[model samples]
Target: MQALTWWRNPGTKDLDAIVCDGSVRAGKTVIMSLSYVLWSMTDFDAQQFGLAGKTIGSLRRNVIRPLKIMLHSRGFHVKDHRSDNMLEVSKRGKVNYYFLFGGKDEGSQDLVQGLTAAGFFFDEVALMPESFVKQATARVSVEGGKLWFNCNPAGPYHWFKLEWIDKLKEKRALRIHFTMQDNPSLSPSTIARYERLYSGVFYKRFILGLWVLADGVVYDNWAAETMTTHIDDVSGYESYYVSCDYGTRNPTVFLLWGRKDKVWYCLREFYYSGRESSNNWDDSQYVTAMGKFVGTIKASIIVDPSAASFITALRKAGYQVIAADNDVINGIREVQNAMNNGKIMFADDLKHMFAEFSSYIWDDKAADKGIDKVVKDHDHVMDALRYFVFMVIYKQRTATTAKKPVWLR
Candidate 1:
């Protein structure tokens, strides 16, 4: 409430911006977005403004939909020009225009280059590149223009943390830190459910709302004894999948997965290290081995995106191959979440995968540079596991869970 009236309040009138950073489901996004709209409508007239998220689709789903409802209930007229990605809002003869933007990558700066905005609201600003933020902020040139930022915390050395957050006084920005406790809408059970969704670095960032390092093992939830399933004890397979990490000079690994109910079992593994072998297998030879490994089992094969030749060989051999979604960080998080939720279990006989799991650790050097990376060593099987869980299982689950609004339907 205070943040919404900050500009009007004599004590905080001099502040130039507002930043809300905190835990997930903590009310930062809702409150900050609402405040931005209210502040813009109250203070400005017939002006251009900007509202952005990591992607236009996300911005609409997270901010625009709920915002439209709130405004309508408040007796304001809202016209969405979907084709133009703009909103025409008015109340009591007062009007304003809000343009939408997606700050998804380094090239996103081009999207906001020509706009002259009275203010800009960035949701999940930490996910956007520094270049996009700089370009977006530069467009807010109108007098009394302000910036509004809301995001879950990232690394300790993230640009926003180093600049806007650490130098809050210098930037004259009001920083509001939030936790799940601040969101009255979330019941205790809901908050607890969200808390169980993350562990290790993610837990610290999304649950505790801390800007800390992602150090130690990447999968703190992994345990060979508890996470592995005996093949003889499982049955009733619904489908099967083969996830591959193809390498010529390095190591090539293929993990065979089978699903039963909500749980996916890593049934078997085929690991070959070319460096350790006297001969490096060609694409055809690798395909032959994969055929033998997957004999008579109809399964979708997911392979590393870089293995073009290998993928062609598989396809030529009458096998269906899918290029894995190779987003390392997101993949790792999904895999970790699967483990935390008991969605995945490995066969006890898969010795090589268990070995790789125990040895896979976060790259401290990368963390020190404010980057999240796992050590490349001992990760072939782990990569294959990540590919299957993230692309096939996690994506399907996410799509299934995201309910579209009634109007959109």
Candidate 2:
């Protein structure tokens, strides 16, 4: 396992220095120092070394201890660190280096001040203030010593993030996102402990190596006002078909779409339900309410095949009701086809549907990386949309009715 860790990152030539990028137990500090002793020795000139973290305590623990072990194993000799907690490394005859300093100290730049370093490493970079990190980077006057920055992504705006990731715009620093699984040495129990302790956004970000946004926002691309075209008058909508995902406990949702002037416009949506008692309407009432909605809009309806009961209720109200063929996988294919062809259109008011549209991910299960929807709650509006597409387009059989549901809708 250690051999694999050693092999995973064979040092690059440009790495007059290299920064190890990984999560907490990813052996970053171990890998960095190993690369340093093995790779940096060949480079000529004075070697200045720096190590720091957000606090003196972390400097003593996470960074220094592991680094010292790696250096010793790799045969680099270290002078005794002073009472002031500074040390240096040497190889046989010609070596220049200084040891750990505390980034945890808010006033740490003074300690790093005026030093020409072969390289400098900033561990747990998110915890350091932006200014202190900037000052440290500025201090590396050595002609080619690499500046080291490594950390689990914390708040996205950390200096390492702003400069190297977000703002550098160019790939100046080699960055990697590593997970606990990458380490391979940790016991299953240890991994489980971390998993049990961390969940939601935190667990995914730190443990699973996902670059996810907090607050559980499934769709970042959803735009109500821009992605949609609004229409107030219903005159030109022509005949309409409504498609629904009927649920008594969850929100009952329906998409109202139609063909007009040879264009598909999804201009409206119906969404509501019975709550625990008062706020949400019940199943029968919800179906009747949908009947009233269909009457008001005066549209023909096709519903999810799974909701046979709802179709019965709609038909009993003297409305033309048909079962929507649900080919979830194919429905997704049709939707993708329309979007790729620039035929899909939405209206400003259908915010929930827009949310589903933005969040509907491809089921790339073979990747086994959990990139698609497995929880299913976020796909409610999408199921309604799939029915809309199944009924409107991708029907396979042409209807005798004149504008046989334009597949683009």
Candidate 3:
């Protein structure tokens, strides 16, 4: 209502645009859409308005559905034309029209190229291409028309943050920030669930509503509390695989992976360090520990390509061992992508693995030199993870008989 009140009197509020940004599902979209559509009824008569999102599908889901519900309650009937992607609202012999445009890519600039709208509402504006945003902004040439935008915060250097959002001035624009707390309907448990789903840069931006940089962490997608679970029951898994990273002075880490429904779970982990072990473990002793780790289980053991001695020992012990694919950048990308898509999970017992993920950083010198490399310190478990993802999981992805996987080649 405050936003509506501000928009109600153009004489009092001279802002040309209002940008609402913050956490996800925070009632920002609902308020903005209701206010924009309702204000357009009295503010502009018998004219077409604009509605945009990353895509037409998203606009329908995020803006059209809820707005229709609100309009219906207010004695208005709304009609959506799916064929042409347009919306029509009618109430007591009055009607307003809206055209949907998708701002998903740079080419989207042409999608709204010639539109002259009374006003516009853009959802998730941060994800839209700058070219499309600028082009769409120019199309709202009607007098008293304003652009309304709501989005979650992105990287500090995101174009939206760098451009119009940061240039807010009195009467020129209104900038409002929201958090999950803004929505009283959201339960505490729901909020806590969202809190556990993001970590590092994601937490800073989505949960805390800050425009932060994404330079430090490599596996920025991991959330230990949410993605890690106890793997006491493994009957659900169709198969299992193991990957190892052997080090004498550093930590020798082994990761056990279980698969179900195309999703991979790091079920358990075994860590042994020559320095940490009181007996000063050798390859044979570590191999004995590895044997106990996967006792009486049908599993493939993938070993580090460099660990020739360990591989020979594992093979001699009647275990199936294969040389792991060690393509560093591709392996990192495979793991990162899996994490981003919520496809990789870890068991809660893998404390060392969790700690490695939490502290893993990109190689600063390599990054500065335009090379993507991770800092090779305390990354024993991470290396094991990469080998598993790249050699085992990625190979499975490509072996499918249907259309080839997009990530394959």
Question: Candidate 2 — which residues are off by over 4 angstroms?
Answer: 1-12, 15-22, 44-46, 167-171, 211-213, 216-409
Pairs with backbone N, CA or C atoms under 3 Å apart (clashes), candidate 1: none
Instruction: Supply the global lDDT for candidate 2.
Output: 0.61
On residues 185-282, what C-alpha lDDT tens digit does candidate 3 reach at each position?
A: 89999998777656655667678988765568778777777787778976568889989999876789888889887778998888877777655667
Per-residue lDDT of candidate 2, residues 159-257 (tens digit):
455566563325444555566777658888887766654444445656765544343333333345544676786556766777788776677787777
Better of 2 and 3 by TM-score: 3
Runs in model 1 with CA error above 4 Å?
233-235, 401-409
* lDDT for residue 89 in candidate 3, whole number 0-100: 81
Predicted structure with the largest TM-score when compared to the true one: 1
Give the better candidate number (1 or 3) by lDDT.
Answer: 1
Q: Positional deviation of 90 in candidate 2, in angstroms?
A: 1.7
Give each model's whole-structure lDDT: 0.89, 0.61, 0.81
TM-score of each: 0.95, 0.47, 0.63
